[model samples]
Target: MIDPTGRPPAEATGPRRAARPERLEGLVVGLVANPKKNAEQFLDAVGDLLAAEHGIADVVRTRKTSITDPIPPATLDELAQRCDVVLIGVGDCGSCSAAAVADGIAFEAAGVPAAVICTDAFRVSADAMARLQGSPGYAYVTTAHPVAPLDEAGVRERARQALSDVLELLVQAPVPVAAR
Candidate 1:
């Protein structure tokens, strides 16, 4: 698939990124939840984990109008200016899964560390989206599939289960240096 930005694949460039902070305390968490069934609920649970455990000072949350559109550049720019790390998701279905990955790519391009969370069933879709976004080997975490049928507790549980991996990626993954 083509990039959402309408750039050709060869011209699809993401910004070179800075390293992740050594610690999470006092950081602001940027969250972009694709308007899938319960994406916001799931992302909020994960954001809460960071805040509760890492002392995150605040959260900036946005819900995209659709599951397929990337978070707008203006929104991403805002998050990049204000947040240390970002999390985007509810990639339970195909198109939304791609959008979630696209959002993470946007964060990475803006010099913010990010995790793109998808469901077990949409793994291929997420990977494909990453590849299309110029991050062929992008790291993503996952919960089980079909969140639309889940209750709040279920979605929260998925968030909790997905937390460790997401935190690991945000805290430990090496930042991609910009192409010189």
Candidate 2:
């Protein structure tokens, strides 16, 4: 495994994924939004579902300044301090997909579990970005493509479709680097 800077890990075993919360009940969740169309709405829908179904206590939402850059380290630190788990996404295109995945990795390293959402059309780009961030095959959630053109209902449906996957990413057991 590689470091977040794309450097080789100091330990022979390498860096590992952050530990996931065993339960969502009463946990604070963060929603990091990209500036893509409808991204915030989708995140809100997912947040609502999580609150209703899994007893998420509260949600903290923020937006990244750019779609193509990682969330700033300061923001990651703040979110880590405020939230137990984070959801980031609506990565409908290549640049945003890469950014979202990178942010997810950064959040994980900061000791917060993050669920990154991307369109299936850009899954390859998301995976490549994870690898570039020194975390090859890093897991994330994927929905159908072209979210920018989606209506509110369409966006909600996509969120509904992706909710389970997002929860899984946030709470599932960490897959060891060697397992990959």
TM-scores for candidates 1 onward, in order: 0.87, 0.87
Writing each residue's lDDT as its tens digit, candidate 1 over 95-161 gives 8887888788778877899888888898888877777766777778888888888898998888888
Model 2 agreement with the true structure over 60-118: per-residue lDDT tens digits: 99997788877887888889999999999879888898889888877888888889999
Candidate 1: worst 10 consecutive residues by lDDT? 9-18
Pairs that collide in candidate 1 are none
Q: Report the Cα lDDT for residue 162, model 2.
A: 95
